[model samples]
Target: MGWSLSLLPPPEPELLDAVFLSAGRALHLANAFENKCQYVLRIANLASAFDEDPALTLDEAIAAAPSDKMLGQTLHLLVDRFQTPVPEEAVGLLNKARAARNFIAHEGASLGSSYIWVARADTLIRHAVALRAAVQALSLGDCIVSRWVSEIEEPNVPAPRSWDDDYPPMVDTWVFGHFNGLLEG
Candidate 1:
């Protein structure tokens, strides 16, 4: 499809800044987009899971998460419920995008790089472009997620506040800073 400015909401300043930081600092050019999009997918799945099984909790979702791309697929499946259709091509694009991002973050090299043989970065970038288009198709209003979070009755999964207190404050400064940017209002 042709690039259409009319189809997208104006980029939010903070969102743009986060995306830039993802590229410049995180060195994951598609990091912000992937993270935000993943959350969007999660919101959708939660809605569906709740609709089908109201008792379903985040732990249930995590439990159901497949070790494969199903973890990612679960998120995208959420959009399908809102009658917002994403092309298979776009889904493929996002896969490569995240894969490339994983490589850069973990291995610091693309598939063709001598370091480790994996998928090509070019293939990943192509998917990134397609994912951008899909994300643009989602209105900001659609992007907003409001869900009920309750105290865990089970002594399982980590607590929400643990993010702030569990780790050595100094050691997690960089991690918290990166994610905190993504969580900013």
Candidate 2:
């Protein structure tokens, strides 16, 4: 059977606002995630170079680092070349985040038609939220790798502050709670 847009009520302004906000946030988060991946890759390369040559200065190690690569290739190098031990759950999340980032960058405009044609703003919002979560997970893994590198570089220094050190208690709890549910289920 065919349907008509006239049969449905106009989209609520509040819902449209939510959809745009969520999608924008997802895009920004995806950008941050990619940057974090690049950083992790760079640091991992530096650490590996230093491991191979103890006498290499920091500048020399940085100079010896591999050239920049795409996100997928960087991740592969991190695992296969640098031997970073990413947990399976984090690897799954990282892959999903990469796909979500690609979709947002390349095909997100297709979702705009659904906003009016099918009045499916909720679907758009859900997609954005999932993208945000996946990117967040990937960024968290980046943080873990960052800490590992920091420790390797400065083993005598005291443990550094956590990423969430400034977050309010409720927000911290909520964020970790969501991840716990995602991880356990």
lDDT of 2 by residue, 27-132 (tens): 6655666776777778778878989999999999989998999988876776665465667876775676577667655554345446344556566555545544
Model 1 Cα lDDT, one tens digit per residue, 1-185: 23322344433434333333433433433355455555556555555666777787879966654333343564455445565675565555556545544544543322223211222334434433333333322212112221111111233643455433332233223322544633323
Q: Write out the backbone clash pairs for model 1.
A: 93-127
Worst 10 residues of 1 by lDDT: 139-148
lDDT of 1 at 48: 66
Candidate 2 yields a Cα-based lDDT of 0.59
Best by TM-score: 2
Q: Rate the local accuracy (lDDT) of all candidates.
A: 0.40, 0.59
